[model samples]
Target: MEWLPHAQRLAREVVRPESRWYSAVATVPRHTYVPRWWEADGDVWILRDGQSNPDAWLKNVYKDTTLVTRVDTCHADTAGIEGIGIISDGTPTSSSTLPSLVVRMYRHAMIADDHQILVTTGTGYGTALACARLGSDHVTSVDVDEWLVNIAQDRLSLMGERPRVEVCDITGPLPGEYDRIVATVSVPRVPVSWLQALRRGGRFVTTLAGTGLILTADKTADGGAVGRIEWDRAGFMPTRHGADYEHPADDVWKGAMEGEGEATSTSRYPLLYPPDAWDVMSMLALTLPGIDYRHSQDGDTRTVWLLHPDGSWARARASGFLDSPAVHQSGPRRLWDELERIRHRLNREGALPVYGAQARVDPEGTLTLSRGAWSMTVN
Candidate 1:
């Protein structure tokens, strides 16, 4: 119980004032749902349990981090009973998503106190927060996994609060009309069923699959919705059909770590950490949806690769500290040049107009972005 005070302090100081809603929600004991978990180390998953080391377990459980709760829809508690050294290489199916990202998502949703909310129930921690802020009667949580629904019910009961926690696939028609719908997972596109379930003027917040962009839109009178990105970045696991994400091609990212190119001159631009934060990556993804990026760092050397479904490829490498980077690219179109174009636009325009950009969604699910006279449409 002593840890509760410390966790609350961290949530308030490190998370709350900084606008991290997930961290405040993390004050709830994540270890309750994740008494055992499997950590990913490259291609392998290692199981860690509460009984193994008390101090280490406590440290990890409350560190404002996300813990993988299930792999391929198989809960860790069941998987661990088999034995140790059992490798589960399947993709992560469910998790207590990181608190900072969760909070960022909620902030984008802009839930009002009296709004009726429908939220995805994974660990139920997010559900608890909704109930804490907006009252249990105002929140309805759903999960496709019945076990999770039951577990969340029990946990909510333990906290002396009750909301309608049910087993329903969110990809399909939801049970009730809601003023705010916040999904903790990503979706390929906004499902029409969600629009059918939303009240007029209701707002929905979600992320696009395969990218870090968050989509926030308000329901419109004509049965569609339109909203723009907030001034933030977030990513989440894609929405699942049954219980997990479809397996990605194993060889898709294979051999990317080999770093097969010559060292280049230092780039004019300073090397960015977590290259996804770069505006170029976001623009590239918007312009070309299926392109994938991989980055690796070893000592003083850094390499970035861009691969496309059409076999177009680009690689950039830098050795030591340098300003102007040598770039190597080959494909239908020069990828580095495209990045340079985006960067140039960013510099000349002083900002890439993504956040607060105008969005219009048609009833047919087409999304169009409009800024000034320039526009891009996504189907």
Candidate 2:
């Protein structure tokens, strides 16, 4: 099947025709990088083989949509043709990010002709796009999974491209200095290794784990960095040290799901899924880091739970869209009250302080984000 026209259509949808990145998006065969992928079906994952349905493959591959390539330890490629309808109990580990977002990220990097860039190698599609914009010699892609690196390298080789593909953890020491560092994966904080590996005055763009923040900063002469949280927001899976993410114990989830709380009250607002609202999620993440969110529904009733590692928990339930939830809170902090406070602030002030906040990173990778008189630090 002819896929060039579809790629061109995607390019037009993502970037201007006059944009320098246009040709790369217009020409690269995205289908080659993603011959198989995993699609979400309610609570389980359904594996898709492109060869099985060429039309569906072209329809999906050329669109501006993210395609999940790996779920936990299960890769779509390794899954057999009969792997359709496979029930996956794990979260998405890697994916071919949507084309528009990839272009936006590269635009944030302000990559120049001579700039040497380090990017994430998820499905190799993003890396391929980078190589298309800058020569293969100017791009380097890295991943924590050796298999991913090896396969990405093989795929790139098929296109007569040989950018540096390595299997080192991105959070650890990098192999070389770069003019720009762009990560599609989110990190807890600015990795110290990234600070050291970026040349002075170099710029890096990344998102923080557990928040929809796009932090773009530059290296400083003093060995630290200074920049700001961008007005644009994005979210990515957090960096993993191994093949799979370390999930909270089942017992911990049970407690958050079923355990009684110390306090109960009527919530100020209707039941809202915090994560569905980017600003609310970001503000909550900034105020209370590592808070886990869970939701469940039974017929007419809907329940949402917020769990923090600090032993704080909040449960809210409602039956209607406009119904105020009965909120229960427990532990050292009143998690629900804090969430309400953030919402109240947004409702009254019109915005959260996290957007376009000034950012400063100490030499040790500590980040301080301040807006107006509000300041928060992440170490």
> Which has the greatest lDDT?
2
Model 1: which ten-residue window has the lowest total lDDT?
255-264
In candidate 2, what are the lDDT values of residues 296-369, reduced to their tens digit?
89987999988887778889999988888998888889989999999999999999899899999999999999
Off by over 4 Å in 2: 81-85
The per-model lDDT (C-alpha) reads 0.73, 0.91
Report RMSD (Å) for each prediction in the order shown. 4.2, 1.3
Q: How many residue pairs clash in each candidate?
A: 9, 0
Worst 10 residues of 2 by lDDT: 81-90
lDDT of 2 at 151: 91
For each candidate, give its TM-score against the true structure: 0.80, 0.97
Model 2 quality (TM-score): 0.97
Model 1 agreement with the true structure over 110-228: per-residue lDDT tens digits: 88778899999988877877777678999999998888889878988888779999898887889999999999887767788888898999998987766677889998999999898
Q: Over 4 Å off in model 1, which ranges?
A: 14-27, 40-44, 71-74, 84-91, 144-147, 167-169, 247-274, 321-337
User: Model 1 residue 159 lDDT?
Assistant: 81
